[model samples]
Target: MTLVVFLLVPRLHLLDLAGPAQAFSTAADLGHGYELRYVAEHEEVPTAQGVPLRASVQWPALTADDLVIVPGWRGRFAAHARLSKATRAALVAHHASGGTVASVCAGAYALAQAGLLDGRRSTTHHALQDELAARYPATRVQRDVLYVVDDRVVTSAGIASGIDLALHLIAVRHGAADAAKVAREMVVYARRNGDEPQRSAMLRHRGHLSDTVHRAQDLIDARFADRLPLAEIAAACDVSPRTLTRLFSAATGMTPLRYQQTLRLERAENLIAHGSTVDAAARSTGFDDARMLRRLRSRLP
Candidate 1:
C-alpha cells in the first residue's frame, strides 16, 4: 500500500489539511492502496480554526511510492513558523530517496527550509508569493496558478487549491478515470491542469443536473477506451439515440461520442508522453489508426 503522510505544523489551516486528506481518503475508499498518517513536531497541535489535532511525534518510514505533504499554517509570515530540524532533514531525505514532497500555501516555507524548493518551480498563496521568492532566491515562485509539480516536489497556491493538487496527484498515480470518480463522489469539479487547457474528462463533462446525462457519462467514463457505439450508450441510459444526443449536447456541449473521443485523446496523449509510440498509444486508447489521433493533436491549441 502507498502511504500518504501529512506533516501537521502548529496553527495549520484546517482546510489545507482536510481538503487533501479527504481526497486521499476518498481514493482509498474507492479501492486505492492508500494509507493516511499524520506526523508533527509535537504530539498535539492547534489548528487555525481552533481545533486541536493529534499526530504522532515520530516520523514514519516512507518508500518511493509514499507521499509526504506539508499543509499551510496560520502565520502571517511563513518564515516566522518554527519547524524542527529533524523534520526538515526527514523531508530532504525522503525526496532524495525518490519520495514525493508537497506543500500547500505557507507550507511551501517548510519545504523551502528543508532545501527542497531550491532551483525548483513552485508556488504558494498569492499574498506570500513575493515573500517566498525573496526568501528563497533559488526557487522560481509562480503566481496565480492553482498548483505546480516540479520533479518530485509539488506546491499548491492556497488552502482550497490543495484539493486540486491532491486530485492531480491521484490522476498521476492512478488514472484520469479514477481521479474523476473521486471528484464526482466528492461533488467537486476537478480543476483544469495548470499547464493544460483541456480539463480532465471527469470534470469537462460535469456540472449538469440531469440524471440521464450523468448515467450516460458514467458509462462513457468507465468504457471510454472501448469501442462503445452511441446506440449502446443511449440504450444503457434508457433513452433513444437521438434523444440522448440532444440531452448530452445540451448538458455538456458535446455528444456522447465526442465526450468519449476526448477521453481517448487525453489518455493517448498521456501514453505518448510516457514514451509510447503514436501507433501504440492509438491502439491503447481505442483508436483504429493514428490518423485520427494526429488530426486531433493538430486541432489542439
Candidate 2:
C-alpha cells in the first residue's frame, strides 16, 4: 500500500512524523511493498524545531493514496488555530473517496476543523481535550483513551502515543507479524490496541485539596510499590483510618483503596508494555503473587 503523509510545516512534531515513517520504512525493508512520501503545503518547509525538509509533493498537487496522515501540529495552543483551506479541501476529498485519515495529538485539530470528526469519538493530548470539545461539539472527545479508531479516522494521544497508533495501523493493514517486526527494529513492543486507557501522567485532572491531603497523596505516589497498607497510610497522614478515608475520598473522588488500585494497575500496564513478563509486572507493582494480579486485572475490564 502507498502511504502519503501530509506534514504541515512550522507545526508538526518530529516523532509524529518519524514514528509512522519508521514503521512503514521497516515494513518495506522486510520485502513488503509500501510507497512512503512526506508532503507539505510547499516543496520546502521548516518544522517547529527549525529543521527544513523538502517534500516529494506540494499540498495542492497531492493525489490520493492508501492513507493520509496529519502529524501533531506546532503552535497548537494558539487562539486562532486553523488549517489552510487547500489542505482542508484535499483531506475532505481524500476521505470522501474512502481513504484512511489519521492524526497524532493535536493533528486531530486539523481533522476536526475539516468537519471529518463530526460525531466521532476521538482523543488528543489531554490539555487540548476541552478545546477540541468546545470547537467540535458534534464530536465526542475521549480524554482517558490512548487512541480511537472511529471508522477510517484514527486519532492518537500526544507524541509517543503516535508510535503506538501507527503500529496498530501497520498490524491491521498488513498483519500482526509485520507490525511486530517493525516494533522489533524500533526496540518497542507491539502496538497497544486502541481500547487501552491512557497512562500518561499528563492526562490526570487536578483538583483543589487540603495541603495535608496533597502531601499524603504525594507520599503515596512516591512509595506506591512499598506495599503500604491503609493503617500505614493513615498513620503517615497523622490521622485515624476513618478520618483518612473521608479526606482521601473528598479530595480524589475515589476511595483510598480504589485510588491505590488505580495506581497499581497503571504501573502494571506500563511494566507490561515495557516488555516485562506478567509475573514481573505483578511483582514490581507489589503484587508478589501471580494469581492476585490476575484477579485484579480480571476485575478491571
Best by lDDT: 1
Candidate 2 structure lDDT: 0.70
Superposed model 1: Cα runs more than 4 Å off: 190-199, 268-283, 289-301
Q: For each candidate in the order shown, give its overall lDDT on alpha carbons.
A: 0.87, 0.70
Assess every candidate by TM-score: 0.87, 0.61
Model 2, span 129-235: residue lDDT tens = 89888888999998767788786788988887887777667655543445555665786643343445543221131244466565566556556567778888888
Segments of candidate 2 deviating more than 4 angstroms: 56-65, 77-81, 190-301
Q: Give the per-residue lDDT of model 1 (tens digit) for 1-301.
A: 9999999988999999999999999999999999999999889999989999999998888998899999998876554467878889999999999899999999999999999999999999988999999989999987778888787899998898888789878876776778888888888863543463324666756877889998998888788889898899999989999999999999999989889999888888767755689999899889889999999999987
RMSD of 2: 12.3
